[model samples]
Target: MGAPGGYGTGFALIVVLFILLVIVGAGILRF
Candidate 1:
């Protein structure tokens, strides 16, 4: 149970980071 929770948290963090990167890249390209 603990392992699954940790894995899910890590996956969420990675997804958030990926989204931020994509938004930043889009903003830079627009400007």
Candidate 2:
């Protein structure tokens, strides 16, 4: 628990990017 803020920030960013990628991927597949 030395740097929870830093770790949480990175994890949040990865999760957001992953969700965005999934959404974009589905959109491409639909078309």
Candidate 3:
């Protein structure tokens, strides 16, 4: 059976959030 579509989208969102968190943490450390 084929994989469900929502799984891909959810995974992408999680990745984006993780990247955003990393960027924010780096910015905080720069100060």
TM-score of each: 0.87, 0.85, 0.85
**lDDT of all predictions, in order shown?**
0.95, 0.96, 0.93
lDDT-based ranking, best first?
2, 1, 3
In every candidate, how many clashes are there?
Answer: 0, 0, 0
Residue 18: error of model 3 in Å? 0.1
Query: Model 3 residue 3 lDDT?
Result: 64
Query: Model 1: per-residue lDDT, tens digit, 1-31?
Result: 5578889999999999999999999999999
1-31: candidate 2 lDDT, tens digit per residue: 6879989999999999999999999999998
lDDT of 1 at 13: 100
Off by over 4 Å in 2: 1-3
Ranking by TM-score: 1, 3, 2
Q: Identify the leading candidate in terms of TM-score.
A: 1
Off by over 4 Å in 3: none
Better of 2 and 3 by TM-score: 3
